[model samples]
Target chain A: MNDTRLIRVVDDDPELRRSLGWMLGGAGLAAELYTSAEQFLERDDLHRSGCVLVDVRMPHMDGLELQRRIRRRGSQLPVVVMSGHADVPTAVHAMEEGALSFLEKPFTKDELLGVLGRALQRADELVQREAAHRADLARIADLTPRELEVMRLVVGGELTKRIAQQLGISERTVDKHRERILAKTGAESWAGLTLLAARLELVSGQPVEALATA
Target chain B: MSTGRDQRQTEPGSVERTPAFPSDAFDHLVSQIDDVFWLYDCQRERVDYVSPAYDRVWGRSAARLLADPLDGLNNAVVAEHREEVRRAFLAGLESGRFEAKYRIRLPDGSERWIHDRGFPIRDPQGRVVHFAGVARDFTERKLTQDRLRESEAFLRATLDALPAHIAIVDPQGVILAVNRSWRQFAECNGLAAPDHAVGLNYLKVCDDAVGPDAAVAREVARGMRGVLDGSQSELMVSYPCDSPDERRWFELRVARFETNRCPLLVAIHLDVTARRRAEEQAVRQQAELAHVARVATIGEMAAGIAHELNQPLSAIANYAEGCLDRVGDDRRPRSDLVDALVHIRNLAQSSGAIIRRLRSAARKSEPRRSSICLNAAVRETVELVRYELETDGVVLEMQLADHLPVVQGDAVQIQQVLLNLLLNAQSAVRHREQPRLTIATRSGKNDVRVSVVDNGPGFGAVAPDRMFESFYSSKPDGLGLGLAISRSIVEAHGGSIWAERVDGCSFFHFTVPYSRPDIASGPPPGVSETGRRLGPAQHKEATA
Candidate 1:
């Protein structure tokens, strides 16, 4: 079997926990068990590669709260909330609070395996995105302050002269700064530079420069 | 005698007049020497003196009157006064100088009122003297009497006009006087004539009306005296008078008058018979209504009572069945097993009897004439609704009187009365905050009364008397039939039933004639007089 990914089980019922562990193990995935959200919080290993299957009801802390706590801890743990009695309203709430999926209890072994597998796949994609985002931020960090400012103005579609006036510099100086920003950001054109910034979450609002900042 | 004007005339005319020596002249003027210088005699013992006044009064010669016989002189007087004049003359003759007043007959036989003065003549020197008197007539004085006649007529008219039966009786209660109206009243009521009543003792009429009872007669006499004495202003008493067959009230008022020396009694009568009859009728109706109320309450509880009886029956059946089953086991000796089986059979018989009672109560179709087995009847009634018992999750218990005498009535009616009671009880406790139905039958002196009690919300503060009326039910969909029919049945069987809340449980009880019937063979063998065969109380315990 490929030891490519892991599935974490969070439940208080020992029987449910064991069942899911065996079920997840049989499905070509490694499984980690946490008796409660509090226990999982105290774990030495973060298990960044797996999807956490959290039971919705427990004696103390419940699944939805656990999901929020995991995200707060910066675990990026993809949570799949499983409820014994799944009602639409509650499932909708779980999904709203960033649950990868909601599975009702007494589910078939296959249903659990299928949902867990999908959850793990989604987690892998998210992990890859996080890694890319980190690399992107590092590369964006190497730009000089003036080069960064030139990059914003160039993506905004301002001509060299306008850029020089806006920045209080010569047009030639503005053109020189924009060329280095493009080289560092690896943007072949102004639109390409905006697209990269969007992919990296570099701005808060919608398409400010891309739609014509000038 | 002269008038004042005459005196003045005489005084003025007396100038130089001889005056005629008036005193001597007046005497001399009336004395006449030739008027009869002789004495006059007439008839036997009759004599007359020659007086100028007599001559004037008689207008006859004195000697001629004296020559008439004394007998003729008496005859000559008015027929009405002859004897009276003779008697007065004789009285005067017996005494000296006799004087007399008489009515005299004149020569023409005309009557005259005369005053005569006479004296007896003496022989010489104050010897006996013949009577001589001057007589004067007073006819004009007698003619002036007129007012006295009118007054006598007015008094008679006033007494005749009174309206009441006014009678003036003597102190002895005799009727001395009665008005016209009193006479008419006496005639109408078959009394004697008013005149006949005058001297009759009033007690004669009272004795006739009140009969001859000495006590009644004495009371009547006392009442009469009380009226006469003024101590009692009026005597009022009721006696059979106009209404001879019934007592009639009479108010007699008697007043005493000094003039008649009698008490006047006035009687007024009135009748009050109808009012008395009406009062008696109202009292009778109240008593009947009270009796019906008592009977109705017992009747309505019949169903609950049946359920109550059913509990014990079911218990007996179970207990007996257990004994029967155990009796066949080899572990027990044959005789012991037979005894147990017999005992079980006896219990079944007692329960059967109970069921029969219940059937009577439940069906209530026909009245059975016999002493009722109340406990058994209650049990049987409970058996009839065994399905209800199980479904309601209610357990019934019975504490029946052991030696209940058979009450006198129809057993079936008693049972139905009880059945209605039991059904009501079961319904009452259905959703009870705590559900239970208890039936108890005890021997009352003349009856075997039973009750069905429930631990549920009680009658909710309704008066028990109103509770048994028809259409009075607490259940939501209840038609209020059970109690009404139960009441009717109980009344029909001459028994009673009622409902009451005790310790939060509804109790319904009724009694039939409690004496047991002939067992065809005395309670099927093993049953004892105390109903020992019915066994001890046993109930199937359940959470419900």
Candidate 2:
């Protein structure tokens, strides 16, 4: 899987593109090439698990614009920018905008490859965290209707008996729902339940609105 | 009967030709030549016979010569040759078959040279009996030989006395002879004297003077050899001679002395040192004068040339800075950035070109020649000098012809010329309330014409002919060399330049030869280029 992680490179200059591609391949990484930001959009391999290499200055569209466009497309690929001539403020701005790194050109092959490797690792971690976070949120969404109501009330600082009144149920019934919430969330008490509800805010926020409508 | 007849004949023949006298035969032989001959009877030491021819040779008859027989012939010879002739004649008579040559004068105011020949006559018994001789006149041959000797001596003396160095070499390039002047010249030049110059090769001298340029040495050697080998005309080679001052010019002339296949050469050297020195001095002075003129012109128009560059340099610095700023923004307008870059490049090139022209002009460096559009140069100069022109209220206009061909010249020099004229025109119209300047350009078959016309106060009564003379300006601060130098620059480019005025406007007109000057033809008549004429209104208005 790590071998199949394809590094995407976007540079208008053919020499820089081939050179960067060779550098990535030499470092035991696969490289996919794109000439421009527009070309990258037309490419179907945007979901590839690798870093995006881009030049700061190019014809038609520059690196920063391409970075913005890639971000809007919500691709998980990390974008790296490079320039031949010095552009200090532009490099600073690109770095501030979640660019993996901004390299000045004539940058050594080792420096660029090192930056790309770190960027690819960061992308992999990001994709995994996003997948795990989505699965946890799906598990929290499977709570019973009454338990979801109590989970929201308990985290909203309402008493368990108050939460039972709001749902027209006994305090014992609310306490029993709290126990199931702690078990499902792997929390030990009400505090743990509240911590689990906060971590599963994606499911907690939506279910409270559904309980309110019911 | 014969005995009595013989007795009578023998008695008479004794006075005429006697058979009984053996000495008479020797006398007859001597008479055949104009010589004195004598025979002595060896046994008695007495004269046996003497010829009458001795009378004509010795200025005395044979009878008288015999009367004073033993006397030397000195008294009868020329006074100077008398004793010498006598001793020579006596010695010849003593020897067998003796000959003597001597001079004698006739009593008739004439001199004669005589060659006397004497022989001893022998008897049948082999005893010496008489001395016989002959004499011939040989004065003409001796006189001719003496005159030839004198002429050769005089020629040698004259060659030695010449001021110019001279030498004569044989066909084999051996220094056969040289004059005194050449010897002196060689000594002064640190070369061996002519006496030691003989038998030396000529190529060694050239190789010493000019460093090892083998081709020149070979060419000269071939020419020298040809001259020695029956060439009719002399060959001459000249080069710069060694001298601290510019005064030395050496001319080497080589000529053959024979018509057939023989190796003999006659080489002569002449020193033209003074003329060469004068030429060098004149060339140096001319260069200095040109430099002075360039400096003076630059000094007079320092403000103008500076102004020409300042504007472009300022523009370039601004555009480059602007480009850097625009490219720094996150909201960088791509089109504006590109435009700024283009502007920066254009300004840089333009400024570079302007600075190059200024440096070349200031340093008096050689001009860079190319085919230039005359109209463009004129327009460029006007814009460059516009500030001064406008300050004087001189409105500049152009009537440039379209599709004009290029002209050949240094563009920078032409621009300088146009700048000078434009500034002059501006200055001329400065006093007027409303000044107008017009620049017109047109092309002909092999030329392009440019004119700067101004209307304010015309040249009035000043003759157009003297306008180009140095220091012939009407203005208080005019350096009259402007038009003069301009015309010279134009003429150097192989074109015609002049100025003419109409009513109230003066037009400085000049032509530039075509880029390829070989194709140029004369301009058409009466149709002034730029299609401009001196209208009656211009002339009358300026005169008023």
User: Model 1, A1-214: lDDT tens per residue?
Assistant: 5665777788875545754554454344688888988998888256568788887766458889988888787777678998755367879999999898998765665676688778878878887988887766665666776776676666656688888898899988887887788787676787877877677544443433332321
What is the TM-score of model 2 when looking only at chain B? 0.53
Cα lDDT tens digits, model 2, B1-544, are 1224323432211433555666667556556775454543334544455667655655655565455544426445677876676676557556544666777766565776777665555555544555544456567776776677778778878888877555666555556667777667555544543353655656444333233333334445667766655443556654434454442345556666664756566666666446545644553443344445656766776665554454445444444444554455667568865665566577678768766655555555344456688888877676566546643556788899999898767675677678767877887887777787888898877788888888757776888768877788877877677777676667656788887877767888888878543221112111111211011111111222
TM-score of chain B of each: 0.31, 0.53
The CA lDDT at B110 in model 1 is 74
Q: Mind giving the per-residue lDDT tens digits that candidate 1 earns over B24-83?
A: 564365464322222323223444434444455555655555666353345445667667
DockQ for the candidates, in order: 0.01, 0.01
RMSD of each: 31.7, 24.9
Q: A103, model 1: CA deviation in Å? A: 1.4
Candidate 2 residues lying further than 4 Å off, grouped into runs, are A1-214, B1-73, B76-83, B86-138, B169-175, B186-195, B199-236, B243-247, B254-266, B299-304, B323-544
- Cα lDDT computed for each candidate against the true fold: 0.57, 0.63
Error of 1 at A27 (Å): 1.9
